[model samples]
Target: MSGPGYRRVAVPVDGGDLAVGVWEPAGETKGTALLVHGVTSSHLAFTHLARRLPGLRLIAPDLRGRGGSHAVRGPAGMEAHARDLVAVLDAFGLESVPVVGHSMGAFVAVVLAHRAPDRVTGLVLIDGGLPLAAPAGLSAEDTVAAILGPTAARLSMRFRDVDAYLDFWHEHPAFAGRWTRELEAYFAYDLVPGDGGLRPATSYATTVDDTIDLTTGDALREALASLDTPTLMLTAPRGLLDEEPGLYEESRLATMLAGLPAVRHQRVEGVNHYTLVMSPEGADAVAPAVAGVLAGERSTA
Candidate 1:
């Protein structure tokens, strides 16, 4: 049987309630898998995967800055996101859920698994997890700047109306080819009427700050090294950046990640960074890989 449709739920975390979209299967399953979306993206990114994983309970959060969970204040860094995931688990009374992260969320998953090994049963890293390849003399600032690209360009939309803001995203190149009624509805849910226009429910500054923090490679590697949770690191042939070859070279990513014990690396050819997470093709490839990893873990247990 196929996975059920997503149910919107608010998970309390400290002072704020983080919004999560859950898609659980009809019958008994192995375990819950928490799906974390990348920066600037929302739970909507997992629409395809939610439909595919019929036997697993899927919990996808809006993180803190991207979707319905944007009410949070302060710098929404990886640690904050990781803590939020823990809070969600606590609220759900679930121990050791398999946490799947895409892009920036992937890094957050790694960090969460590292910080709270007992909380995360397994980790699925999608098109993220490895550090970017650095040149001989490139500074951290330069490396971060390269990762940000134009998507990091400041954009404050003084929308003529909420529909205008919705239209803006509808026509966006990143989303243009894949716009669906579900995504359209997801976009609309996160737009709030503001001072004569609509502003994203999320804080722009919070998003930017999170982006800056995640691009750095130093603390993440340290965190990954500490993670004893079973990890499934899936890399897209195309990187997160629109570049054909991504920041994490397949050979290099596997080689570097090999140092981490019990980590399985899979190279999914033909999908780019973003599409690899959002596309139906990506869901098809990723869902089975995740299921296989979980199955292998169960066998070992």
Candidate 2:
């Protein structure tokens, strides 16, 4: 975290250390907030968010089996992740804070709030949170494949060097013309030395375990059914590939959110799933959204 106003902290959990990224303003501050990155993403993903909200202290962690915490032990599931997050809160000696989660991180936020409702004051879900509809009768493996597409495949890829990895993401549809220095740093942080070359630090097995659990596990179902936390869901119009309708199709989201009056949904224009938080245009929408969450206000973007 050589970037301005950022520092790293290691919070010990049951199985291993949770790598946390803390960003503080150079001067006065408003308060603190917890940020949870997407599956396969590291705490660095929130670098842009941290800069935009400099007045607010930001705490983001590399979840078990991802980023610097990739080796953290234990099964991958929502409950397990929630427990790790609770440990992070305890380490900071903070009772509760507003939470902002991106992609799969939003799923973790839901469970975190449900299991330890007192630990989260409000939730800001970026391009995720409400569950995606799993195709009927699909096997768990197939579900992972169908849902994640190229994202899951990248874990198996080996890059000859840093440039090769950057080349890979450089061609990604979601990031076309949206690249930045932060994006460069993000992809570089993803690599760890492998047997023959540099491979991504995120564990493939853990990704499978988490994807299966989030898609079919009972934990998420139980959590959302009883969820009462103040939450706002911001969605990107496009998905991981810059495809239309995103993870939550317009018609589908309306139906899925119908039952949960406690949750609110707002669609952000001109961004894909990856850009909704990582890019400047997306951050313009997302950073201000946090203000409403902390103020306990219900409004649309």
Candidate 3:
């Protein structure tokens, strides 16, 4: 289940088709869950989660602007992503399933729940979902750069080959000394031929479009503001590059969760935003949390 064993399917969406990966359970299926990846990341980000949750079917999709769906022509935003996700569920005949979204995917999940409430049973938002704001006077491009930093820059970089790309990621602080074969495979899948070399398959233009829409768009704020479904927001102590004070600070998270009683916040130690869903330790922590959501259990911060 750890290898690239998931069945890849192209789910048709508006403007084009979306690439989705489905991992059917080896044993009697306990349940099904839809896993959404981050901005600039593919569905392979859930490789660790697939290994941990082998009993349940895991369906993950490369967002319209990333991975196999990078060529999907359309605006990239919460509403666009939510529409694509609903189509993915429809293709699988899934009436409703618990959703686990990481980083920007979490924000998309919130939008999906808001847009089509009955389609999502519950939500597990890892390291994202709350509305994000950029410094005043920042331009659209700089806003994305300020929030994503290297993650956005890497989209335009070209590598000599897959190994070169692997080397680049190996030096990353969040991935340093923690790289696995699964991670290597995920990085390899991220590249596509470009300009006499290979560049990440994620569309830089779409990334910027989505970032600006999320940072300044009213959809996400309006969605979270009127939230009603049960949600668990997991935070990592370290930031994207293993820096201190991850995405959600306690004071800030508390203030954000004040009016939304359905959203609960919990911090996962010894992990960063990337590792929270890309590492074995992270999968262990998240797998059970998803089960709790499916079972209607109350998760406390």
| Candidate 2 regions with alpha-carbon error over 4 angstroms | 1-4, 297-301
The predictions' CA RMSDs to the true structure, in order, are 3.1, 2.7, 2.6
Which 10-residue span in candidate 2 carries the lowest summed lDDT? 292-301
Candidate 1 lDDT, 1-301, residue by residue in tens: 3448558889887558888888877677666788898777788888877777777788888888667887765557788888999988887788877788988888898888778888877888988765656444555445444675544442355576667767776655555476566566666776766686776666667766665666553457678667677788888776654466765776777678778886778888767787676777778899997787677668877
For candidate 1, the 10 contiguous residues with the lowest summed lDDT are 148-157
Model 2, range 22-87, lDDT digits (tens) per residue? 998878867788999998999999887777775788999999999999889888888899999999
Model 2: pairs clashing at backbone N, Cα or C within 3 Å: none
Local distance difference test, each candidate: 0.74, 0.89, 0.88
Please report how far candidate 1 places residue 108 from its true position, in Å: 0.7
Which candidate leads in lDDT? 2
